[model samples]
Target chain A: MAETGQILNLRRYRQLRNAVVVWLTLVVLGAFLLRIPRIHILEHTARNLYFHVPMWFTLMAAALVSAYHSLRYLQSGDPIRDLRAREAARVGIFFGLLGLATGIVWARFTWYLGTSLWWNFDPKQSFVVIQLLIYGAYFVLRSAVEDPEKRGRVAAVYNLFAVVTMPFLLYVLPRQMESLHPGAEGSPAFSDITHPIMRLVFYPAVIGFIGLFWVLYTQRVRLALLEQRVEMLQATMLEAKS
Target chain B: MKTWLRGFWAIFEKDIKLELRARYAINMLLLFALGALVVMAFAVGPTPLSARVQAALLWTVLLFAAAVGLGRAFISEEERGTILLLQLNLRPGAVYAGKLLVNFVLLLALNIVAVGAFAVLLRVQVAWPGLLALTLLLGSVGLAGATTLLSALIARAAGGRGALLPVLLFPVLVPLLLSAVEATRSALLVAEGWATAADELLTLTGFGGAVITAAVLLFDYIWLD
Candidate 1:
């Protein structure tokens, strides 16, 4: 408990949280207001590049953070590291789902316009769904463990294993297939399709959303720590009375 | 090295003896695979199927059958209360290697029966029997590696039902599955034979190698914990 106060800096978190709010607000404004060259299918929905792609970037960032914390937990046996890992993954999954939803909508409007198809089994989209299921299983694994310490260790190990497999899901296998997503074979990559001006907003949006993930993750960690503290207090009080 | 091999052989022999005597896990796995194959054969009754479809169906049956039966090795150990005794007597690496060998053998047996049923029912024409065998061997390596470690993890978790096994496994297995399906399809189609399917075979080999190494390294953490 000596390190409880040191685990999170409330003032710093608040500052970053406020900055992220303002930054993302500007990003959304920039996404819609700024004019860019329109491709055939992706006329105005090119704006989704700012919103949709950033969610995956944030998801990947959060996954890396989660895996890092899990590795640390394994090495040090720190429950705080485990808690951070779980919270990071929880937020990462939120972004992954958002990425998936936005991808579906983006695909429906742009590519699958004439046909009534929400999911046509784009390789990238399918892989992302599998990625979400893996994280979903992580949450299930955590809930299935009764003891907090054991849960942390077991969940941390699973998290690390999942992260190790992510490169295959996100990169190797997807690249081997024809994808509707940018950067695939036969598809124009970001450099070709995306206007340079869009990168100005897209990069910032990625940073902003990742910052937002950090804020949300920190808040959850703080709430969880408080709950843990209260449980310890109740246990101690019961012992004293008995 | 010698001691490790000896320990692994002991565990492997013990499992084989138990499997021979009870035959519970293997029988259930075989029956499950047979039932699924029959239903699949009936569902696609008398229709001409593409090589891709046949390959996909084969791997799907293999994957699901594995999902159902592969966890029994670890789960049974936990259930029988011999896990602690085994833990005390053997190194985790040896235990993992032994279990992986056992699971790999079981998966091969299941694959043989399933693939046999699949070929006969669907009237599969194998252009390259050697390539198909190689694909199955590589695919089984990755599948066995993944399920064995995950089964150990699942066995320790409360409420870790049999259902959770596939949920955790399928995602990690996507790369291997994709390559396996492709290689198998190529083998059946007689398209470009070994040359074109070489990429997929390489991917399968790499995936199996990497996963097994990771499992060996990580098994200690799961076992000791």
Candidate 2:
């Protein structure tokens, strides 16, 4: 606990955490209060774009952070970099699950209204589930290794591979298929189709969610560092006694 | 350069001789694939499943058989205590190439068996045998390369010998498998849909090339670790 600040730069973390709270508050307000033009079939449910889209953006941001740390781990062979990569992945997958749950709810009520179907095989949605499963295996792989340095090296390599697969799984392959979700020729890609008023909330929401991911990721890194220190201390005491 | 080729050949021949002696992994793969096809035939009951459904089923079975086939990529080395000695003697890249070649050869043969069963039992006809073979070739390259690396990674983990292979593999395989299924569908069933399938085949080739290239580059890290 005493050494945690040294590991995490506590002041900067606190500052960012505070800023994120206030920032997300304002984004939430804007999200609920902002007025926008409405259209058939989407109506008010279109507001979900702010919340749902940001989850994916945050997940991607977290993935990039994780992969960056993994690359550094491979280059430097640092355990701390391994810890950062692992925590960032854990947080990224959290955001991914949230995104999936939100998408299910949003789709069930909006496009799937009265269909009695909770999980229609939308290409993007199905592909995202696959993406999440890939990430899920990362943790399982982590759990299967006992040596700290070896685990770090192997998991870093695997993490690099996982992140490399992310773009193809999440976007490239799905786009090629006949999905009911737009992004095909007839529809302005979700980016071009949204309202200017919504952009006000959307941009901040993206930043805020990413900020939230950072705060959570940093928290995990600090805690894991503390745990590592305790293990070191215990190992030293046993060595001294022996 | 000569030594590198020699090292590669040694590993490739070792794996081939090992397999020939036991005839174990490939036999299990063929049996699993044939069993799955027979089960599907029973379940679907003679009236032909749609071409798309047939394609999906075939790819699914092939992917699973691949999982079982190459999941033992490094297990024999571990069991025989040769991994450390192999690492001492061979470049990791050469080791990767050999293992990948072994998987490629084994999976390519197993794939032919599975495809034959799909045609005979599932009553699916191949409209273009050459194109179907090409699609299988492309699909198996990615399959062999990826499973070889992943199996090696899993071999040293706390988990038993590649038990987690498919769990870690299937998601990453989706893109390759999807393209394989589509190309197979077009090559075997879809009249002149072959023209439209050019992009899918290209994607398959690129994906296979990228995975194999990356595996060769990165295998040293996990292997030596």
Q: Per-candidate RMSD vs. true structure?
A: 1.7, 2.2
Interface RMSD of each: 1.5, 1.6
Candidate 1 per-residue C-alpha lDDT over A1-242 given as tens digits, one digit per residue, 9 for 90 to 100: 56688756778777888999999999999999999887888888889888898898888898889999999998988789998998998999999999999999889988899997898878877877877888898998887878888788788878877766666555456645667777777788877877889998999998999888988998999998999989999999999999
Per-residue lDDT for B1-225 in model 1, tens only?
888999999989999899999998789889998898889899999999999999999899889989998888888888788989988989999999999999999998988888888889989999999999999999999999999989988887653587889888988888888889889988997655799789888888888887888888777877885
Scored by lDDT, the top model is 1
lDDT of 1: 0.86
Candidate 2's C-alpha runs over 4 A off are A1-6, A170-172, A179-183, A238-242
Interface RMSD of candidate number 2: 1.6
Model 1 CA deviation exceeding 4 Å by range: A38-40
Q: Which tens-of-lDDT digit does each residue in B74-94 have in candidate 2? A: 888888888899989999988
Residue A85 alpha-carbon offset, candidate 2, angstroms: 0.8
Per-residue alpha-carbon lDDT of candidate 2 for residues A1-242, written as tens digits (9 for 90 to 100): 35444666878788889999999999999988888788888888888888998998888788788889988988888788899999998998999999999999989988788897898777777766876787788888888889988888778878787655555555456545555555755656776877889887899999999999988988999888888889999999999999
Docking class for model 1 is medium
